[model samples]
Target chain A: MATSVEQPQTLIYVLGVTVIFLASALIGIMYLAQIDISQEYTLYNIQYSSTVSRMVNSPTCFALEESFELPEGYGTETQVQAGIIDWWKFNSGITKVCSDGRIIYAYLSSLDGTLQKQLLTGRDPLTALSDSDLESIDNWNTKQEKYYVLVYKDSQLIPAILEVRIKG
Target chain B: MKKAGGAFLTELLLATVLVLIIAAGFFGIQHIPGFSLEPEAKALIQSVGDNEICNVNLLNLIRSPNEDGTLGDTLITSYLTKDYTVFNETTTNILNQVMLRRWVMNLSINNRVEATFGDPAGFVAVPCIAYVPLPQPFFSNCSFSEIQTGFDGYEINFTTPDGNVTMEIVNQFVTDSDKIGGFGVYPTSEWTTIPETAIIGEPTTINDTLNADLLILQIYVGDESEEVLIPYELTISEPSEDPDGLTEVHLTKKDLVQQCSIALNLFVELNNE
Candidate 1:
């Protein structure tokens, strides 16, 4: 009879311990999963910003070139201004003029959403990212939009933005 | 049965120990810092938050030509003239267009917030702040005077960037239970009453709205009164289109470039929703 009583007590103890252990394991797994997700998102943000900065500041990209009359009738001097997009240059595939090895897929649009032009740099992602792949929830990707000054034709400067989406 | 029970207890103990070891190892790995993003990655993230984007946006905006084919001098003109209409319109329109997230932009002159454009509410998370260095505005517009109301006490009057402010000593306590004497703030057009509580040695604060941005006076009515630092606001008003003779209404390029040195702060928050 004493043995039987001790067996139930030990069983209860073991049951309680198992419950607590399982609960802790579940919580730990959830917490670690959260940390992983956050870290990935942070990395994606860093990558997106890096790519956008490269495109915006690089003269070979969409940066607008300004012309000014030099002193003493030195004709005219033209130089690239960072963060200013030239519409003509963008249309002429300026990115293709010089390959930077890095992949970029973006769209430039007017602030009022009037005009939108697709920008692609590098390859593979074009073939890798299918319509179904984009819709998949598990697909890792980051998208960000940044503002820029769009120089239309050779005169008008309109406010514009670039939206970049990256998948890796 | 006794032997079986003992075996069960031993197995439970072993399981507990194994679980603890695994948990400890997992947690230990997390603290090692090897599983994080690289330093360059972190810096890039920080720049993305504020610096890189803000600098690019602000510079482009400043360089953009206005309606009259003049370089964007909105920030300078607004600070000098104190007419935020054009500045607000330009910044608001562009910011709304460019920003894909919620943000607040504050134009500060001498560390004083002159103009704020955004709803600074609800989103209380950490903001990515971008600070753009500005030329120091000439603080040539400050005046001060003291008027003796009675023998024991007097009133101090001063002008700041915001407006005029007047502070007077309170000779009598508001209530018998009041510990320390406070100031009666007559803020030019408004009357401000002081709090009736005090901590024996500390100076009493006189809160007024006249120059809320720049002036806050704390008067200690004790033996050998304490001298407080008086901060003056910038007052050299440049030219604008205002008909009021109080400010110079004509803004010149030279004045805008040389005189106006108002710093800009862009606080951006990614809209998680």
Candidate 2:
């Protein structure tokens, strides 16, 4: 009779543990809700500065998009005249393209999957990122700041990330 | 007692999680991307604005009637133009094509910097357009509602109370790519140089900035070159607005920097890396 009573109590303990795990996971998702979406890019076919000048003289991109689900719809990949929009759309931040299209990802400092109502901030990253070394990791301050990293493989955008906190 | 302690700990964890969520909502997301501007970039943007201001001042040098009827000695003599005729628009376009034909006009290093901005004809006071609506028969199959001119890109005209007023820009161009190294001119008596205080330099490059001559233009090509006009006498068109509708009439330096930074940054990122 004691053993039978103990089994019911243990079952209740397991149920409580499962509920706690789900709640904790939900909280984390909510905390890191926003994705600083950037572009997955490839090198331009033309000369650098000229491309930049011509891009500035061109019209603004005619469309906007919002999605986090798979096969995420970024705009049609076309060459622009090397401007701010190009920078954001072609950032190879976190999730990268693999040889066979499988994604090899890294941790980005951001809240995962929780934002709704994404706004058009229209902030340009290049105006701030003038001289930062692209290939280094130390430039990132995981505590005070984080880089919103965009990743690309085979010249395609995958998931991006931003470091929210660094554990010492 | 042990069970009560576990439940208490669980409650504490939940509270912590709630705090994290709220903090992220308020502060965390915005700072990540928007605050990335470097000090150098800010300085460069400011220089670009400075250049645009200098350019606008040059336009004010000619004696032109203000929005009021009073005369002001601005670089632009007047915004008043005759209503554009189809033929006049065609001729002006052809002239602009010739005027804009890129070539190196030479100068000695000591030549005075000569710069001006606006519709070329407005400064020159050339009467080019006259009102003549499409005569009698309209072409059934055509896209030519109005005769288009090359200078149209440089001009933006809108109607105001006294009469129709138009504004335009005249860009200085270095035509020959090869001779750019020693390309220059010695100031002649005809070239008018603006004061040192007013100079439109390249926004970012120290090398590009100078008390260089007020930039000038020459129509080495067509008869109608200096005669292009855009009249705002009609009431259909709406006035242009800034990116944010918070203001009227002027596009602030902050606005251009916002535009240029976004454009050039994207260009560099996409084209180079």
Per-model TM-score of chain B: 0.36, 0.19
- What does candidate 2's lDDT look like per residue over A6-107, in tens digits? 565565556556665666677556644643222211111112212222222232321112323332233345442211122233232211121112211122
DockQ metric for all predictions: 0.14, 0.02
Predicted candidate 2 versus true structure: per-residue lDDT over B75-163, tens digit per residue: 11221122223323322332232221211111111122122122332121111111111111231111112211112124433222222
**What fraction of the native alpha-carbon contacts across the interface, defined at 8 angstroms, is recovered by model 2?**
0.00
Candidate 2 deviant stretches above 4 angstroms: A1-168, B1-7, B22-53, B56-78, B81-273
Q: TM-scores of the first chain across all predictions?
A: 0.56, 0.22
Considering summed lDDT, which 10 consecutive residues are worst modelled in model 1 chain B? B245-254
- Model 2 residue B209 distance off true place after TM-score fit, in angstroms: 51
Q: What is the lDDT, from 0 to 100, of the residue B134 in candidate 2? A: 18
Give the best candidate by lDDT.
Answer: 1
- Candidate 1 lDDT over B1-273, as tens digits, reads 677677677767776777677677766655775454344344445545445666677667666667634334555566666788887887778877787666677777556777888767655232333333343343443222222221113443433332344444323112122212121211112223522111012223324333221123342221223432233222212122222212211111112221235566666664342
